[model samples]
Target: MRLAAKANLGEGTISDFENGYRMPNPRKLAAMRRAFEGAGVVFATRGPTLTQPRWR
Candidate 1:
């Protein structure tokens, strides 16, 4: 999938993350953020909570 290609991660790894079988490290999280942001996703923070990114 695009996420896997963009993150330089295997499909299994992506699947694992999605399935909550594993958690991504800081580096992988950054890669994911970059990939999503490149696709026009913008993350927002409200107080101590994290909200979903706004799509443009």
Candidate 2:
């Protein structure tokens, strides 16, 4: 699915955002994060021992 569709955003929104021509609000940001997570992406900070703790 397209990023916009996966994020439940309007068509072209993702493209615009990727092009730095648009910015998503907090809700949209969360939605985008969820979409990425659904695709098996895990967002986290790298630890000193190469371990990445979970996000929230």
Candidate 3:
């Protein structure tokens, strides 16, 4: 998701998170959610049900 300008973070920092080079702090995670929301996007996590498991 594209972060908001007011997120006050540099592009490289975000890139690192996306590339798995870094994990964002809780505050930054909240900011990212807000940023996506501002852009009319929503982020979600989904997992399979207990009755259905898939191999990775």
List candidate 3 stretches off by more than 4 Å: 1-6, 44-56
Runs in model 2 with CA error above 4 Å? 47-56
How would you encode candidate 2's per-residue C-alpha lDDT over 1-56 as one tens digit per residue? Answer: 67687788987777778889989788988999887776667677862232342333
Error of 2 at 45 (Å): 1.7
lDDT values for all models: 0.74, 0.73, 0.64
lDDT per residue as tens, model 3, 1-56: 33535466778778899899999899987887666555555454673223332212
Provide C-alpha RMSD values for all models, in order. 4.7, 6.4, 9.5
Instruction: Give the Å shift of residue 16 in candidate 3.
Output: 0.3
Q: Quote each prediction's TM-score.
A: 0.72, 0.71, 0.62
lDDT of 1 by residue, 1-56 (tens): 47888778788888999999999898988888777776666676742222454443
Extract clashing residue pairs from model 1: none
By TM-score, rank the candidates, best first. Answer: 1, 2, 3
- The whole-model C-alpha lDDT of candidate 2 against the native structure comes to 0.73
